[model samples]
Target chain A: MPTIFVYVDQFKGAALSASWETMGAAKKLAGEMGANVTALVFGHNVEGIAKESFAYGADSATLCDDPTLADFRAQPYAALLAKVCADGKPDVVLGPNTTRGRDLFGMAAALLGASAVADGIGLALKDGAVHVTRPAYAGKLLSTVVAKSRRPQMITLRPRAFPKPEAGAGASGSVTKVEPAMKEDDIATKVTGYSVEEGRVNLADARIIVSGGRGVGGPDGFAPVRELAATLGGAVGASRAAVDAGWIPYANQVGQTGRTVSPDLYVACGISGAIQHQAGMRTSKLIVAINKDAEAPIFKLARYGIVGDLFKILPALSAEFKKRLGK
Target chain B: MHVVACIKQTPDTAAKVEVKDGHVTWGDAALVVNPWDEYAVEEALRLKEKHEGKATAICMGPESAKEALKTCLAMGCDEAILISDPALKGSDSTATATVLAAAIRKMGDVDIAVFGKQAIDGDTGFTAVAVAATLGWNALTFLSKIESLDPAGKTIVVERSLEEGKQLCSSKLPAAISVVKDINEPRYPSFMGIRKAAKANVPVWSAADIGVEASQVGAAGSAVTWPEIYPLPAREGSVEILEGSPEEIAAKLADGLIAEKVI
Candidate 1:
C-alpha cells in the first residue's frame, strides 16, 4: 500500500504546532489516496515526540535520535531524510514550511533528484498523483503543481494552511528506530550558539495580528499597537516602511519582502496599505483598517474601516476590548 | 576569492500580476532584477571589495534577462554571465539549480555563491540550498550577517535569522549563502556604472556549453508540473466605515468582530 511520510519538526524536544497541522493534512491526503500516514521524527532524545505523533494521527513513525541531529545542520538531516525515503519508498512526503523545514526539504529533494513543491496551501489526489496548490507572484495567483513522475513526491505545507488535529491521550502507533546517516565530523556546518527572543508570539502562527506602518511616525508609535496586540494575546507586526525607518526590527516586518501572514484577524493601524503590504495579509479572515486618512488604500480591502487618528482609536479600542473580554 | 551572485528577473514588486487565459501575466509592468537579489549583489560586491576578490553575476533566463545582469554589473559586480537556452524553458527549481550548478562548475574555483532569500515570483526560496546540495558545498541560508571570513583558512562565520531566534554558525568555504533584506542596503547604480553596464558584454551560455544535456534541463528534466493557474477568489470589499466618538467606534467595531467570531 502507498504511504505518506510527514516530517515531525521539533526544536529542543518540543514539536512545532505546525507539525501536527501537517500531519492533519497528510491524514486527509492519505484518506483520498488510500495511503497510510507515517511520521518521521529526527532529533536528540526525541522519542516522546515520536510517540506523541500517534495522538496527532500518525499510523506509524520512524525515529532517528542522535546527538549529531540535535542541531539542524542541513547536511546530516537532509542526508538522513533522503536515505529514509529511499529505503521506505513512500509515495509522498510532507513537511511544514518552517525555516528549517524548507532548508531540509530543498536539500533532501536535490539529494533524491526529485522536485519539491514549497509553501503549498492546498493538496489533492488527481489522476493518481498529488497536486499541490501554491501561491505564486507573492499570493497574487494560485498555481496547481504536481511532480508528474517523481517517486516520494515532496511538499512543504504553509503554516496555518491546514487545521491542527486534536490529540487523544490513548492514541498510539508503531515506532521504528533509524540510524543516523552521517557522523558529526562529516558535517561541514556547525551551530556555534543560539540567541532566542522570549515572550513574543510568532507572527506566522498567531491568530490575531495588529500592525503599524509609516504613519506611526516613530519608534514610540508602536506603543499602542503593542498594547492592543498584548491585550488580545496576539503578535505585533510592522510595515516595510516602519522597518525601513528603523522603527522596529526586521523580524516584525510584514510584506512581500518580509513575512507573509494569514491570521484570523488583521488590524491595520496608521497604514496606507501598499500593494506589497497587501500581499502579505490579504488572506486574513477579517481585516480592519484604522488611519487618519480616509483615502488610505487599506480602506479598500478592509472589511471595517475607521477614519480617525490611530493614537486615539487604538487606545479606545483596547479599552473597550479589555472591558468586554473582562481582561 | 571568487564570488558568484545568482540572480533572476522578476516583475516589479508593485506590479499587479494576474492570470489570464491560463497564464500568469503582469501587463505593462516593468521587469527588473528580483528585489531580494539586489541585496545579494550588494553583499557580493562588498565581499569583493573587502577581500580584493573578483565578483561575477550569473542569471538564467531569456535574452531579456541581460538587463538584469546589467543592473548587477552597474551595482559594481566585476562581470556578468547569462545562461540562456531555448530548451531551458519551463524548468523547475531543481532543473534550474542543475544548470546553475553546472554553470558554477564551468566557472571553476568559485569560493562562494550568493543568492537572495527568494525570488518574489516563485517564492520557493530553495535555489541556494539546492545548488549547494548539487555541488556538495555548505549551505548557509537566511544569513543576516557575515561575521567573519578567512580566505586563507577557507572558513566563514555567519548569523542566520531563523523563526525562533538568531543562530550563530560556522562553515568551511566554497559555501552557498542566501542573504535576507537585513544584511545590507542596496545602492542605486551610479551614472558611470550604468553607462559601463549598457555597453558590457555578458556572455550567454547554453545547456551544451555548460556540459549539461538538453534532457537534463527544461521541461524534460523538471519533476514538478503546473497543471493549472488561477487567481484567488476576489475578496468582498464592502467596507463599513465606523462613525461616532473614538469610544463609540471602538465598541461598534468590537461588536462586529464578535459577531464575525474572528476575535
Candidate 2:
C-alpha cells in the first residue's frame, strides 16, 4: 500500500497542534487512497514525539534523531528529510504550511523530484489525483491545484484549516528510528538568537482582529481602531498601505504577503481591500468593513459594510461596544 | 563581495493569468519585474551601497525580461544577464533553479544570492531553495530582518517571519535566501537609476552555455507538468446596496445575512 509521511514538528517538547492537524488531514487522504500513514520526526528525543503520531492515526513512525539536528536549520534539516524520503519513498509527503515547513518542503520536493502545493486549505481526491484549494488574486478567489505527477506528491497544509481529531482509542502506534544523514558543516545555518514582539496576542491564536488601513489617515488615527479592538477583546492588524505609510508597525500588517489568519471576527477600518490584504484574511469566518467609501473593493467581500467614514463609525462603534460591556 | 539577485519579468499583479490547454496565458502583456523581485533588487542595492559590493541582477524569461534586468542596472547592479530562448518556455521550478544555479556557477565567484520569497503568479516557494541545493549552498527563507552581516566570520544572522512569531538564525557565507516584504523597504526607482538600467548591456545566454540540456530546459524537461487548469469560478455573492436609513439598512442586512447563512 502507498504510505503517507507527516512531519511531527516540535517547539519545546510537545508536538505543535498544527503538525497533528496536518497528520489528521494526511490520515483522511491516506485512508481515501487505501494507503497506510507514517510519521517522521527529526528533533531531540524522538521517543516522546513518536508516541503522539500514532495517536493521531499514523500507522508507523520513523525517527531521524541526531544530536546535531536537535535544532532545525534549513540545510541540515532538509538534507535529513530528503535522505529519509529517498529511502522510505512515501507516496505523498505532508507538512504544516509554517515558514520552516514551507522552506524545508520546497527544498525537499526539488531533491525528490516531486510536485509541491503551497497554502493548501483542504484536500480533495478526484480521478486518483490530489487537488488542493488555495487563494489566488490576493485572496479574491480560491484556486484548486492538482499535481499531475505520480508518487512523492507533496503539499503543505495551512494550520487550523481542518478540524483536529482527538486521540484514538488505541495506544501509540509502532515506532522505528532510522539513522539520519547529517554532518557538522551540513548545517550551513545556525540559530544565533531570537526575540519576538512583546506582550501582544499571537495573531494565530487570536479569535478576533481589528485591522486598520491607509484610510485610517495617520498614526494618530489608529487610536479609535485600537480602542475598538480592545473593546472587542481582539488583536489589531494593519494593511500594507498603512504599514508602508508609517501609520502602524509592519508586524501588524495583514494580507497575502503579511499573514494568513482564521479569526472568528475580523473588523476592517478605513481600509481599501487590496488583493494582498484580502488573501491573508479572506478565510475569516466573519468580516466587517467600515470605510468612508462604500465603493471600496473591501466592501464587496465584507459580510457587514458601513458605508460611512471609519473615523466617525469607529468611535461610535467603540463607544457602543464599551457601553454594552458596561466598561 | 558579489550578490546575484534573480529577477523575473511577469505580467503586472492585476493581470489575470489564464491557463488554457494546460498553459498559463495572460492578456496583452504589460511586462514588469515581478513585484516580489523588486524587493530583491532593492535589498541588493541597499546592501551594495552600505557594504560596498557589486549587485548583479539576472533574469530568465522572454526577451522582454531584459527590461526587468534593466531596472536592476538602474538600481546600481554592476552587471546584468538575461537567460532567454524560445526553447526555455514552460520551464518548471526545478528546471529554472538548475539553470540559474549553473549560471551562478559560471559567474565564478558569488557571495550571496537573493530572491523574493515567491512570485505572485505561481507561489511555488521552491526555486530559491532549489538553487541553493543544486549549488550545494545553504539557504534561509522568508527573511523579515537582517540584523547584521559579518563577512569576516563568513556568517550573517537574519530574522525570518512566521505566521505568529519570528525565527533568528545565523548562516555561513556563499548562501542563498528569499526575503519576504518585512526584510527591508524597497526604494522606488529613481530617474538616474532608470537611465543606467536602460543603457546597461545584458548578455543573453542559452541552455548550452549554462551546461543545461534542452531535455531539462522547458516543459519538455519538467518532471511535474500541469495536467489541467480551469478559470476559477467567481465567488458566489451578490451586493445588497443598503441606502436611506441606518436602522432600515442594518435590519435589511441582518435579514440578508440570515438568508445567506453568513451570520
Candidate 3:
C-alpha cells in the first residue's frame, strides 16, 4: 500500500492544532487512495508529539528528536525530511501552510527535486494522484493542481480548511526514531531569540473576528470594537486603512496585503469594505456589518447589516451578547 | 554589497479577476509591479545607497514584464534585467526559481537577493526559499528588519515577523531574504527617475542565455500542474439591513446569530 506522510508542526513540545487538521486531511485522502498516513515529527525531545499523532489519525510515525533540530531553521529540518522521503519513498507529503511549514516544504521539495503546492483548501485523488484545490489571485479564483509525474507529491493545507480529527483515547502507533540529517556547526542560520505576543487569540485560528476600519475615527475608536470582540471570545482585526493610519498594528490588519482570515463569524464595525479587504474575509461563514453609512460596501458582503453608528451599536451589541451567551 | 531585487508583474489588487472557458482572466485591468515587490526594490535601493553598491532588479515573465523592471529602475535601481522566453510560459515557483538561480549564477557576485513576502498572482510565496534551496544559499524569509549587515565579515542579522512572534536570526552573506511590508515604506518614482527609466534599456535573457534547458522550465518542468480551474461560487449577496435602536438591532442580530449557530 502507498503511504501519505504528514509533517507534524510543533512549537516547543506541543503540536500546532493545524497539524492535526492536516493529519485529518491526509487520513481522508489516504482512505480514498488506499494509503496509510505516516506522521513525520521533527524537534528536540518531541517523542510525545509522535505518540500523540496516532490519536490524530496517523497509522505510524517517524520521529527525529535532536538538539540540533530544536529551533525551526529550514536547512536541517528540510535535510532530515528529504532523507526520510528518500528512504521511505512515500506517495505524498502534507504539511500545514504556516511560515515554517512553507519554508520546510519548499526546501525539502527542492532537495528532493520535486514541486510543492501551497495553501490547498481541498484535496482529492484522481488517477492515483493527489489533486489540490487552492485559491489563486487572493481567493478570486480556484485552481485544481496536481503533481502528475512527481514522487512524494508535496502539499500544504490552509489552516481551518479541514476538520480536525477526533482524538481517541489510548491510541497507539509504531514509532521509528531517526537521526539528525545535519550537524549544528554545518547550519549557518542561528535563532538568537524570540518575542511572542501574549494573551491575544491568533487571528488565523480564531472562530470569530471583530474588525474595525477607517470609520473607527481614531486609535481610541477601537475600544468598542475590542469590547465586543472580548465579549464574544474572538480576536480583533483591522482594515488596511486603520492599519496604515497606525491605529492598530499590521498584525491585526486583514486584507490582500496583510493576513487572510476565514472565521466562523466576522463582525465588521465602521469598515467600508474594499475589494482588497473582501479578498481576506469573503470566506467567512457569516459577516455582520455595523456602519454609520448604509452605502458602505461592507454591507453588501454581510449577512446582517446595521446602518448606525458602530460606537453606539458595538457597546449595545456586546451587552446583548453577554446577556444571551452568559459570558 | 551588491543587492538584487526580484519582481513580477501582476494585475492591480483592486482588479476583478474571473474565470472564462477554463482560464483565469482579468479583463482590461492595468497590470503593475507586484505591490509587495515595490518594498523589495525600495529595500534594495536603500541597501545599495547605504553600502555604496550596485542594485539590480530582475523579473521572469513575458516582454511586458520589462515594464515591471522599468518600475524598479524608476524607483532608483542601478540596472534591470528580464529573463523571458516563450519556453518559460506557465512556469511554476520551482521552475521560475531554476531559471532565476541560473541568472543569478550568470551575474557571478550577487551578495544578497531580496524578494517580496509573496506574489499577488499565484500567492504561493515559495520562490525565495526555492531559489535559495536551488542555489544552496541561506533562505531568510518574512524579515521585518535587517538589524545589521557586514559585507566585510560576510554576515547579516535580521528580525523575522512570524505569526507566533518576532524571531531574531543571523545568516551569512550570499543569502536570499524575503521582506514583509513592515520593513519600510516604498517610495514613488521621481520625475527624473521616471524619465531615466523610460529610456533605460532592460536586456532580456532567454532560457538558453540563462543556461536552463527547455526540460527544466515552463509547464514541462513544473512539478505542479493546474489541470482544472473554476470560479468560486458566488456569495449570497442579499443582506438584511436591520433598522431599530442600538439595543433592538443588537438583540435582533444576537437572535439571528443564535439561530445560525455562529455565535
The candidate maximizing lDDT is 1
Task: Report the lDDT tens digits of candidate 1 across residue range A1-327.
Answer: 999999999888899999999999999999998999999999999999989999999999999999999988899999999999999999999999998999999999999987788999999898988899999988878889999877888999999989998997888989999999998888888999998998978889899999999988999999999999998989999999999999999999999999999899999998999999998998888999999999999998899999999999999999999998899
Docking class of 2: acceptable
Q: What is the TM-score of chain A in candidate 2?
A: 0.86
| TM-score of each model's chain B | 0.98, 0.89, 0.97
lDDT of 2 at B17: 60
Task: Give model 1's share of reference contacts.
Answer: 0.88
C-alpha lDDT of all candidate models, in order: 0.93, 0.78, 0.92
State each candidate's clash count: 0, 4, 0
Off by over 4 Å in 2: A45-48, A65-67, A136-144, A167-171, A201-207, A227-234, A309-327, B16-29, B237-263
lDDT of 2 by residue, A10-99 (tens): 764567788888989998998799998898888877677888788888898898777777766777778778888888888788888777
For model 2, the DockQ equals 0.42
Question: What are the candidates' C-alpha RMSDs?
Answer: 1.0, 3.4, 1.1
Model 1: CA > 4 A from native: none
Put down candidate 1 lDDT per residue, B1-263, tens digits, no spaces.
Answer: 99999999999999999888888899999999999999999999999999999999999999999999999999899999999999899899999999999999999989999999999999998899999999998899999999999988999999999988799999999999999998999999999999999999999999989999988889999988898988888787689999999999989999999999988
Comparing 1 and 3 by DockQ, which wins? 1
| lDDT, candidate 1, at A290 | 94
Ranking by lDDT: 1, 3, 2
> Candidate 3, A61: how far from true, in Å?
0.9
DockQ for all models, in order? 0.83, 0.42, 0.81
Model 1 pairs whose backbones collide? none
